[model samples]
Target chain A: MDEFSFINSIKQHSYKQSSLIKGIGDDAAVIRQPTQDIVCAVDTLVEGVHFSRQTMEPWHIGYRALAANVSDLAAMGASPAFYLVSIVIPKTWSSGEINQIYVGMKQLATKFRMDLIGGDTVSGQELSVSITVIGYVERNKARYRSLAKEGDKVFVTGTLGDSQAGFHILTNPGYYTDEVYYKERHQQPLPRVDFASKTENISRIVFNDISDGIANEANEIAEASKVSLILYEKQLPIKDSYEQFPPKLQHKWKLFGGEDFELLGTVSNKDWNELQIIAKETNTPLKEIGYVDDSQSNIGQVFLHENKQTYRLQKKGYTHLK
Target chain B: MDEFSFINSIKQHSYKQSSLIKGIGDDAAVIRQPTQDIVCAVDTLVEGVHFSRQTMEPWHIGYRALAANVSDLAAMGASPAFYLVSIVIPKTWSSGEINQIYVGMKQLATKFRMDLIGGDTVSGQELSVSITVIGYVERNKARYRSLAKEGDKVFVTGTLGDSQAGFHILTNPGYYTDEVYYKERHQQPLPRVDFASKTENISRIVFNDISDGIANEANEIAEASKVSLILYEKQLPIKDSYEQFPPKLQHKWKLFGGEDFELLGTVSNKDWNELQIIAKETNTPLKEIGYVDDSQSNIGQVFLHENKQTYRLQKKGYTHLK
Candidate 1:
């Protein structure tokens, strides 16, 4: 297909949004300016670096790419509004495969009513999809990593290491008995947008999304906040099936594996119970993983406590530049 | 450098904007939302496709990518407010090269006070830069390709074929005498944001930025606006230097060459002189190239008149896909 036809085909996926005054037919998409504070983030998934052709279909790649950006907005307790995608396609991809990609994004975008407004489609040797999402948040209510304080309790939504475990299962199919659950997790890990919106009532919180594992994410919050975090290894929530793998392999996945798409952060001790109540009402898994401490090495550290032994969690995960 | 440190280094490029509440240190960039109607667009440039390493430097590549997106905003008569760049780096690119890229973007961004907000940095096999820019335009005042009508005078800003001539000079050095002028045009083709802003007071006009030469852009307006355009060949504006090339090459560059970064569209006859005055006051070259016509095919036709011979202009230029 020509570029114009490709663009016109994707327009079929765009749903009517009151805020958008102009869409595909214009030089640029025009929208009624928003009045609420808005947060925007971009995430790109590249072939080989992010996903393998052996493991992922075009549909899931699209879904995962959009979800990654939405997860960032969710970390700030924002509601998704609009998105634009810039995709590089290799000639090896079929036209049908590309159409499936848009269908996949449309499925996830409809969950939050995100309107696709603009994008760039170009040919390249490798496929890469970069999506930018814009979402609304209340001015002072938006959360940030630097907002965490000494007395706050660290919390995590959903189970840790689930996506990595799922990815492992996808790569090594028959080795895991429960392939369905793990494979689905790998394919369509949901962004906690609803959970974020539910917690918007809280006056203050420090939030980060579990994109590059707790080790890296925790370090980000700790470094940005200029405080330290301590996690009880026994408190980490993981699926029981993790025990089937070798012990070191099992342990490493939870602490260092990435792409969980779950929310991780700190909240006031008094507000902790209310958060759990909201999680329970919404049926989202919630766990108290650790606490922020001023007594620890204060220039931003993360320590893990297991079997009466404590050690610093290595500050690394899924870095593109090293 | 690790991802966090790499992100930290890019922090130096982020300038402060009153609308931006958070920048490099946050999970997502947050901004005090705009109050006027806003328009956004994205453009991507892939290595070997948009530029050649032998001809263009890293700095000019960055400038060209961002300028492409700003030109879209300019076409809509929007004032640029914010921009985000998602760049992919190949293993061959050094850190200093990447820093130079951002420096190139910052030079043009500072011209219109565009702020860098949020983006993704990832590793890939080929270098690609995708830039998204958001701009403010008054409600119902923004221009569109689908707004031209019969009897509207077709106009073009700046000169045509200048970028193509410059690009040729760069690739085939000693053949062209005016290297400085054409080379600058190819390296830093300015977006018509200023001219667009000056003409924002006009009640009606159709505008399309000529990134894909006038043939493609004029055809786009004709197709989108459901009209026809007839250009007088003698009225086409070009530098006297173009005659140094072969006659066919000279003619082809003006009609089919891309990357001029000029503006082309139609204006009402009564409003025509005012546009010329504005262009003159701003020292921007303006020319009346053609007129919208109802006598031709209503299904969007473009025709060129030369030496008592009139023929159709091909509907193609610089498309990434077949």
Candidate 2:
């Protein structure tokens, strides 16, 4: 697939967002002049660190890069306008494969009304894609990791550990051939960019896209904000089949295994009710898994069911170097 | 080096520009509301395609990625602000080596007040880096590739083939060991970001960053704007030492060797005197290489000698895929 051909195929069907004054094929893509504050985020995915070449498809890789960046915009309480994608391809990867990745990326871009703006392509030793997404939020509406205060309630969008479970199913498809729900959930995880935009009532919140598992990102938010996060053992949401795994590994995978691409956010107790109402209107479950506290002043320790029991969260969130 | 460590090292010396509201350690770097239009551009460098892995230093690699993107923003007549870098490193490269790369990036970022903001780190099969730089320009003053009108005089900043000549010396250090000027030119290229901002009387201009050599980018401007560009071959700024190479290889390298990262742009004939004045003030030479014309409707065919023996210019510029 020629680069232009792949890009053209993507432009064939897209959401017509007015924010992109110039999208793709220029020195830079121009956006509608920012009326309010603009928020931008960037993320990169490489072959081994982010995805296993043996198990992941090009389309999944492409879709995840776009979905992942969009999730950051969502977490910021911004609407995505356009994204710049820089892709480096290895000789081993066919242009057709790269085109499939673009197809996946375009699908997400269209759904999010995020135009694929300008980017660069260079020959590399392995397949790597980096994307910078630009979005906009009303002035002062952006949620940041530093915004969480003591007593803020923690909430999560969508099901966690599903992507990790999906990875297992993807690698060992025969293990769950009889269970279609298990396979589908693992293969196609949704990014809640649209849903999160509706939660405007959750004011003065802090959030992160749950890429490095829920518990790991929770620790980051806490540590970065200089507060402590406590997740109740029973309040944690888990799929029924999640219990079938070896208990330690299952918890480890859910807590640290990444690529979930969900959103973990905090809001005041007053706003938490509004968030629940918003989630209900969309027919999606919003789970309250934890809360922030000023007392401990450390991050990522879970409160256990046994009285006064606690578990130290590992610093083993996905490190790019590792 | 650990990704965070390298990022911190770079951040320590990075200058904070007045336009940058936030830099590093965030989902994205935030820019203070620009008082003018923001011009943005991105560029990538790969180990094999853009530079030789065996010859180029890690710091040089880092520098070029940032420099090339800065050149693009400069071509649009924008002032550099902060930049977001995306890097992929091979596992074989040592941490110290990667740290030096960040150090090199830090040097240039400090020089230009372009903070090294959020980026990605991943283990890839080879080294690759991509940078997106955002800058500010008054909306009406922004230069574009489509703004060149017939009779516009094409001007180039600095000498062109020096980088190509420098590359040859880099690959074969023993070939011209005594010539420090030639060797240094190849190892370090200065992006003309300063030129675009300071040059006056360049309104409604068309230009591009000459990363892919001037001849090739000249063709791109011609193609994009649907205008014919005529080169005054006698005015070609061939360096004296470059004459030592076989005339064919030397000319080929000058025409096709990439990574020059200079500015090739056009302005009205009336601005020629003003350009010369600015060039003298800045101690940088601006040469009149050619002009845009509707008569020929072909790019780069011109008289080779003062006597006017015209020859066809080949579009033998560097192409990544080719």
Candidate 3:
């Protein structure tokens, strides 16, 4: 079974719906929305670059593709819908492993009610998977990345860099691997869809997923929005195991390492309490990291104050291409 | 500029319409289609597996990705609308070449009005381009590969094996590149979108694109439709250059080499003249190649008779894995 056959077999078990005009074999899967418009996104994951083929599980590989793309829709304040997947795998890979990947993707798709519309398959030297997810959002309520303003408080969901810390645990056993929090955060980063829908007033906030780590993502928002962002170094959230590391390494990994997939947004200071309320209602943590500043900031450098000394925090982020 | 920057530049130039809820920068680009369902498909072209990176221009590489996916949509009789692209390039390649590829895709997208949406870019050892194209089709007009019957006359629009001929011309040069008809067919494939749209009575026809040569595609339709297909050797149309080749080589290239991207369908005999009328109206040729037969009668073989001897055509079709 090639990748195409594996996808087909999973699609074969999809619940038949009249709204799906065409599914799983065309250029695109056509899903009808008599009263709604379609929301969509595309994500690509490559072996060695996105995941180490030697250590990555087929299920996790499949799960992350769906999760990462769906998180994009969530950031846009949209609901999940159908998706098309394109996969290229080495011909030598077994069909059984490919099937397990689909099995993993199907678990998520089923939970999310995502229709596996259509995609293409071909043989290649390395594994590459690209998924285009289509969802729906009210035209009036779609989110944007250029909405944050001056005096906005920077907000991030859940613990920052937990995923990165999880990576370290998985990679170096001498650090911390047996801890449930670290392992789960690394293997399965939850997309904050529930938190997104609950926070309506924050829709206009500059939003990004911490796939590239909070430090880099914060800088992205600052650069794109054309504002200086001040991250409080001491207030920065770090896993307990991460704190046990040498100060230099801890700061480096937490600030620069990515793969967190957590939501980061900036809201006006006035909405801080309201933001907390929404997070409470959704039972999701919305951590306040710092503030959007007007200083002549040099991109993503953080400010630290320690023992009668002030220091600049340089970017210590993950670099995929490097 | 890197691959990401080049792709980002392409996304930046995409037109923003009210119908497009989200354009780029997110995981996916979301669009609203009031009541119409969307058709989507993806196709990936690798450096050597799909095209020779050394000879093929970047623009053609981009064009082929869009064209191939567009061809798939045409097979489903879906209207072309939007597409997302993901590409991986080697470190040694220049960003200028990558931008040129996007320029190629932009030209096609501009011509077709298919919205250029979102994608991902990464550095890799070999170049690979993947495009997911989305379109819309009425619920009732969508076509598939499972509708052919025993009595259906198999037809292919335009000429067959021209891509293989083109490949030969470009690779070997001494073949057919000298002939204008063969040269253009090899370099610029005219997808049968016009012919596909005119395929009325689609409910009674099995549909697919002839990418992997007609013989291989016939086998695919045969396998999907659970029927055997027989091609009349005399009825197979060829250009002048094809005849110049050795007889055995001519048949072999036409039967096994793929990437023609033409519309190949099988229709009931009753709709034959009507199809011809539609073809004439559209100024496209729908040539009759063979007939569908009982699976038990011939298995998966194409039959041809020369003088008094009957011979079975071997499955010499191009395999991506191979």
Per-prediction TM-score to the true structure, in the order listed: 0.87, 0.84, 0.80
The CAPRI class of candidate 2 is: incorrect
Misplaced by over 4 Å in model 1 are A1-34, A317-322, B1-34, B317-322
Q: Compared with the true structure, what per-residue lDDT tens digits does model 3 show for residues A1-322? A: 3323433332323423444433332222334466654566777888888877554688888887788888887776667766667778787667666666666676776666665655556778988888888777654455555566678988788766676666666777774534668767776677887787566665465567777676766765665566766666666666556666567766665677677777878888777888889889988877888777766544433444434454554444322211
Angstrom error at residue B86, model 1: 1.1
TM-score of 1: 0.87
lDDT of each: 0.77, 0.66, 0.67
Q: Model 2 — TM-score against the truth? A: 0.84
lDDT for each residue of candidate 1 in A190-309, tens digit (9 for 90 to 100):
999888878877888878888888897888788778888988989998887767777886777788787888888999998998898889888899999999987754558888887787
Off by over 4 Å in 3: A1-34, A175-178, A200-203, A268-274, A293-322, B1-34, B175-180, B198-205, B226-228, B292-322
Error of 2 at B239 (Å): 3.2
Error of model 3, residue A219, in angstroms: 2.8
How well is each residue in A137-162 modelled by candidate 2, as lDDT tens digits? 76656666767788888877766676
Rank the models by DockQ, top first: 1, 3, 2
Residue pairs whose backbone atoms clash in candidate 1: none
Question: Which clashing pairs does model 2 show?
Answer: B1-B95
What TM-score does chain A of model 3 get? 0.79
Worst 10 residues of 1 chain B by lDDT: B21-30
Most accurate candidate by DockQ: 1
For chain B alone, what TM-score does every candidate structure achieve against the true structure? 0.86, 0.82, 0.81
